[model samples]
Target: MYRILIADDEPMIRKGLQKLVEQSGQSMTSIRTAENGFHALQQIQEERPDFVFTDIRMPKMDGLELCRQLAELDSDIQIVVISGYGDFEYAQKCLSYGVKEYLLKPVSKKAVHDVLDKLVRVSARQRTDTFVPVSRLEQWIAEMDDLVWSLREPELELLLEKLRKELHHYSLKLARFCDVLEELNLLLAKRLSTRDVFSLQTHLDLGGARDVEEAWSRFAEGIWSIVRDLKARRKGRAKDPVEEAKHYIEEHLAEEVSLEEVAEYIGLNASYFSQLFKQSTQETFVQYRTRRRMEKAKKLLQQPHYRITDISGEVGYADHPHFTKTFKKYTGFLPSEYRQNLGIE
Candidate 1:
């Protein structure tokens, strides 16, 4: 017994659709009607209907805008857009917002019944198929963040494919999909800062995309562009082994990075690279790594949500006691005392 809303500009059409839906003998609990998209949005907010039948052209807001707003508010609600033949392409674009069906002008009783029947079947399937747990979603987002920061072309393409599959499989609305993109953007900004990668803020405008596919395409392109720019920057700069080692250290702060590994990566002897690192940074490799770990640990401590153990692991200390000792040595206070002193708890 799903609640339904029919929004159209004309009174006769609204009445006709309402009557048609009632007479269709569908499993509907309530039937509501509105004269335009704005009024329909109001009804939706108040009633939280399960399905919406809206016209393409309406006052204050069009069907597409209504669909977009509705998706942001509630992704679970199903939308069926009604449009004339002239607005067919526009109606097609509304599908990106997770519209279930598109009905052309002068919709017949049979068409309404067929759409309702299809909705019932689709809803039934979705009940089982599209129920992604919060933990799984978080895992996917974390994996995506890792792949983006890896800056490998093959992995990037795999991520794009995964995104496309998730978009279809989860039936993600524009809002949720945009949220995924936003998380990726944040990860890019955080990880690429070591190499001075360009800002992706302008390119992450998912709201301005014409459709979901366009948004995804733009996002993929932006990732590729970033990868290319990073490569170009690396190539254009004269090889500075010490600077390269520093960038590598910054990027791999969580890893158990060693001077030998970095020296090998930069095609330099370990002893020579060690001297160069100490000379350039005014600190030995071990001291620099410790300082970076302590600095990151302090920043993580400032956030109350981060547990001391979690912060310890994040900064590459597997043993909690060791991390506490190191933190105290660097900041003159244990992580807990530091947080308490700052009144973070």
Candidate 2:
């Protein structure tokens, strides 16, 4: 069982996400809500939740700052960003701060349940990830990436053994430690073929390990787990990344999304995702996004209550004239003209 902390300025959002998570049937020790990032941090320090679901826009600290600070802490708190359709671009930025998972504004039970599922699977031992501020890990990242990528077990073993011997020479300070850990996490994430970003932290206790041998064992196990999981995947057919990208695009029709952001979201190289997307859908990512936006705009235009100006923003077109031109090009009718034919002034 684990605890969860939900943070948002909107009381309704906080309450709604909390309700969905409760209904997800995940074992939870406690569930709490915070009005803003400040309160969220306070709860984080006091309750020590295993997961945090936060919104990008909040009253005091905002999700960006909250995540930035949390990224620096030597804890294993999984963060999931929640944002409105229009704020996805901003929400997407949170991924850089040691966050790999996010849910759109309209929270679904399946999304909530899926994130919890990943947490459970990764934490099978009830203790899989706990980051430490160690400097030596940074230098080994490039070499380790090659070793893990090629699945060179012997070289990998030799490297870790050498690393184990040098652990005693390292000295850690909080300020510098967090930066190193963050860098290590990001670097490893780039090399990983996992579905999304997952952290690589040692299982050793935060304060101390029983002995040097125990610490080395815990750290080595974490590294080996990556190589083993990749080996297993190589034997099986990987899931279709293009389908996942399409779903992500359909959900974020309002945000200004780029090919790179979507690629990073699903843990694929941008160039690779581009090639696969075109081969599968016969449309470039840009072409797909444009078509989706026009479709969304048409639907909004059908609603008489939604103003033309607002409709443009809803479909990700900020400049009114540009949206008008694009709408005309897509449907051969301006938004105003389209609404006019529907008999609404």
Give the per-residue lDDT of model 1 (tens digit) for 245-312.
88889888888999988876765557767876887899999999999999989888899889999999
The lDDT values for all models are 0.76, 0.74
lDDT of 1: 0.76
Clashing pairs in 2: none
Worst 10 residues of 1 by lDDT: 194-203
TM-score per candidate, chains pooled: 0.38, 0.38
Clash totals, every prediction: 0, 0
Query: Candidate 1: where is the Cα deviation over 4 Å?
Result: 129-345
Over the stretch 135-219, how does candidate 2's per-residue lDDT look in tens digits? Answer: 5565677788777766788998998777655544454333223333335546666655342323333232212232345444645
